[model samples]
Target: MKLKQAVTGMAVLACMSTAAHAQSAGTFFFSTGWFHLAPQSSSDPLTVTSIGGSPTNITEANTGASLSSADTIGFTGGYFITDHIATEFVIGVPPTFDLEGSGSLEQFGKLGQAKQWSPTLLFKYYFNAPTASFRPYLGLGVSRVSFTDAKITNSNFEANVLHGPTSVSTDSSWVPVFNAGFTYAFDQHWFAGVSISYLPLSTTAKLNSTSTTVVGTLNIQSQTKIKLNPIVTYANVGYRF
Candidate 1:
């Protein structure tokens, strides 16, 4: 009779184990969340490379800039390659960032504004058993970064310093991302997670302005290099299928 009771207890434990299993191979999942970006930013001195289609050497003092923090909605989708390995695609609505003058230019307060787009692909390794309610992960990834709608917003700075109405452009590039996070499974199909990532990124902003000077019509071109190594955070809730 004791042997029969032992067998029954073992069967019950097996059933419990199966019930606790949440993530597994070949499963597809999606998540939506809050995303925040804070830039550790700096810039090179603003330099004029050309004036009226001719090369010139001119730089502005304290004209380097810094980016303010931004927030947006974030999304992620992935498929489990194995019980411990997954690949995810992450993206968000392009967030608008404010630019403020730095160094000698700090007194001006506001400098400009731009919108950023960075979509990422990550290979993540999850730790702990699939049946465990909580799991932590580390990810390595690449993000394609770009900017748009860049413009000088301050009137005094634009007219006096730039010499005319100025239009702006920017260069884009790809960068490496380092990520770490944890997820807690509320049930077999529902989970919540939080992650933080760092990106070492930089870009160049090109400026073009047209002015009717005493010398005649002049086209001025200038540029600056900005290093925007950012720390990003995401908090999410997900569902597994």
Candidate 2:
């Protein structure tokens, strides 16, 4: 009977040790991964205004101002505030996307390029016991998406279409992000995970053109609304310390 009790006690001690090592307060984790951004992109009709003429609307289906998908490396870091709660920061190298024309402007090919940098902050709740090899998590977060390096890439469109120097700019905005994922622990310190997030992001793009026409330096303004509801996916290998 004493031998049996001793064996059970040792087993219990081992289980406790594993649980403690898995997740504890003050533990820090870092993850690096590959990410893909697939955007369900849509745009409003381009509204064009000329200094000498009335504003006119160009339909998106006619202009084809759509963006393409992007893939890049992503990173995340987290701090376990408790055994079941953590705060994480998600970031990565900014991804560049090519703006393309589809319907009427399809012949114009690539219209321009826009690069975005979005960093997110999340408060996550992990489920199951800390000793469990697999834990699913849910997170609510905020992401700030800013666009830069937006320029007109098609020389023909600028010279023939605009008849002058054209510049492009995008408006920045903040949005909410929703996340769901699971992490599998290979050991106490190493793990692998996959995450999925959705962000309902929207912005306005402005195109400014200066043309030396018979009417003088004609200042033309064009604006478009772009809706990018992107579903982002990540596969990561992580370590905890």
Candidate 3:
């Protein structure tokens, strides 16, 4: 009787252990990776004119100094509400960009720099599969972008038929965003993904005089509204705990 009771108790404990593992099949994970955002297009106008004089209207076109792609790095923390539903918070440094344009017929070197930081909340839905490997997901989120510590240099332009230089500066604002992507899980603890997002960023810029020839202080204010379509491709390593 003693032997039989001991066997029964061990069998119950084993069954409980199996049930617990099955309930927690999906795990929490943290990821950090490098991101590259290519400005597929910008609808913002690059307005250039004299500070105190009549400003020239430069419309948004395939001309002048515009951004191409910027390098970015960020981190993410997420958890699985279920095997098919999850949420995450992503934080990262803005991609560094350069504007390529001729200053009054002279090509300037990297006219300025704009850096951004954003915290985004996202909801993800995973596809059900026989195996966890090769799991694909889609996501949506909102982001707040802050641009700061912008610096401009080596700018020259043509004004009143006289060769002169100009100074460019700007302030940042918030934008609405949307994104979609797919993640492929290589194992229980590793994954990689790719995504694209649209960001509506608009702001005003203050033009200042940085020319020795151009006299008087100019305060030309211009408004620019841009919708950025960024194709983000990234590969990340994640740890599930």
Candidate 4:
């Protein structure tokens, strides 16, 4: 009876130690990754006329611009609320874009490049033990994005007869965002993850008239609306403390 009791006590102690170790395994992490923004619906409206005395409405004519490939990078920190649940804060930079066209007669340019800073709050649930092998997890979060110091270049016009120059400037606004992601751990301190986030943003731009040495200065005012969706992918090396 005494031997049996001693063995039972040892077993209980070993189980407790294992649980404690797993609970305190990791408390901090950092990651860097590359991201891209998928195309979303965009519109531009302008009131101008062709030199042939024809009405030209950019938006009504579906003559706008498309964006190009962009790069994104971010950092994150997390704290465990329970043994299998944690909350994290993620911050990222605004992605830059270059404009393309669909072979329309409208004037096209780079439009501008935008940069954003976002702070997101997330909740994570770990389904398996935080081991040195594969550990998969899920997260959900809300983000706030800001755009700054955006610049535009290559804003010119091309037509059969009207060959001249034009320019545009813009201002940005705050947007609300949401994201979902999964992370795969290769070791106790390294992992990779991919996430997708949606942003509801719009802006307005000022159109400037240009001269082709004959048409002189043509004063014009126009408005543009832009909506975006960004998908982020990342691979990181982290440490547990």
Candidate 5:
């Protein structure tokens, strides 16, 4: 009876070991969740003027634009090449961001809006055994931030400031991203995670204006450098396959 019981106990242990390995090494994962972008933003001195009009300089003390926080549905796909190393691609449904004038341009209010698509590629290293229920990871990545569909929203800004019809646009660029996160495994195939990432991003906003009046014509072109260094956060549930 003792010999039979020993054989059964070894069989159960072997099954448990297999279950633990199923979550790591050579696994593929997919996740979907909430992603939020909170911009800690600022801008350089703004110098603008209209042709045949007075020029105004908005200094560092007076140059400010506040970006509203935005959220969207986020998705990620990952492949584990080893027990501790993985590669991931993160993407999301584009989100619209509202820009409000602050400091010198505070009176303008709701200056404009733009749509953003930011996609990232990451290399991550997890710091725990494959069987552990919890793992913490650190990642380094690069992101492509593209801004499109920009529109000027404030009427007064156009009539009073630009003196006529105006067109606005933003430049797109790439930036580095740093990530720190943790994952909690619920079972062999199910897990949940939360991550925080920082991106130091910068862009330029350009405006072109033209007015035809009794006094011939007036035209103006202006550019403003904006720093949109943002902290991005994510909360997700995933399946390991």
Candidate 6:
């Protein structure tokens, strides 16, 4: 009858209102999805810093490296402080990148590989009202960047270029991140988002090699400074609590 119809209409309206205010204050959200990382990378010439525990600065000519693009799963967790402000923490399953030899080292092809880890925390400002279905945001943050499993994987390069058996190590540092993205709420609890971030980062790869001369085995220490300015893209689906 009329009473049942009225109740049903009111219920529908209530559902719509709930869905409309998905990004309101005091909301906590979590998302998981894909991250693609592309590095605008460059490196200083490879240098032999020391030989047999003695200082000998010898730089190679046209010997540098480039990093290959990588992809991995990414996650984001955030809390809304207000209708237009939020804080988020982002991380990814560390992706391994290939180091391709450049310039004078180009003939060696694959120089090495390493896994990169960068966990970031961002303070964001969202544009538009809380009730809107789509919102865009800009964020500023810092990342703790590190590397692991770095090594000279090419044996030919290790023997001919390094002139020995070589092992690798890398330095860690802190870098700033610039981020921007947008989210579209499907309802009160479900949403989809895409984001892009940039980081200006650099690290040094240190190499230790043992070479056998006519005399004996000599330990050689060498290093190269590399700039890895990467642009990262993320696409995810999320739920709000």
Candidate with best lDDT: 6
Clashing pairs in 3: 65-100
Which lDDT tens digits does candidate 1 get at residues 1-241?
9999999999877755653445878878899999999999999999999988999889887678999999999999998899999999999999999989888778778989999999999999999888788899999999999999999999877887787889999999989999999999887789999999999999999999888888788899999999999999999999987
- State the local distance difference test value for candidate 1: 0.91
Displacement of residue 163 (Cα, Å) in model 5 is 2.5
lDDT of candidate 3 over 1-241, digit per residue (tens): 9999999999877755543332233657788888777765443445544344666774434333455588778788887777677788887766666644433322454555666566778887777542445666777777776656554544333242122443445655555566667666654456666665666554454545433434654444333444445566555666656
Candidate order by lDDT, decreasing, is 6, 1, 2, 5, 3, 4
> Model 5: how far is 62 from its true place, Å?
2.5
* RMSD values, in order shown: 2.4, 2.7, 6.0, 6.1, 2.9, 2.0
Which portions of model 1 show Cα errors greater than 4 Å? 1-21
**lDDT per residue, candidate 2, 1-241, as tens digits?**
9999999999988977765666767889999999999888877766675444657654434654688899999999999899889999999799998888666667888888889889999999999877788999999999999998988889987777656788988888899999999999887788999999999998898888888977578777777788888899999999998
TM-scores for candidates 1 onward, in order: 0.92, 0.89, 0.68, 0.64, 0.89, 0.94
TM-score of predicted structure 2: 0.89
What is the per-residue lDDT of model 5 for residues 21-62, given as tens digits with 9 covering 90 to 100? 755779899999999999888776555633456564433357
lDDT of each: 0.91, 0.85, 0.58, 0.56, 0.84, 0.93
Sequence-dependent TM-score of model 1? 0.92
As for model 4, its CA RMSD to the true structure in angstroms is 6.1
- Range of the 10 consecutive residues with the lowest summed lDDT in candidate 1: 13-22
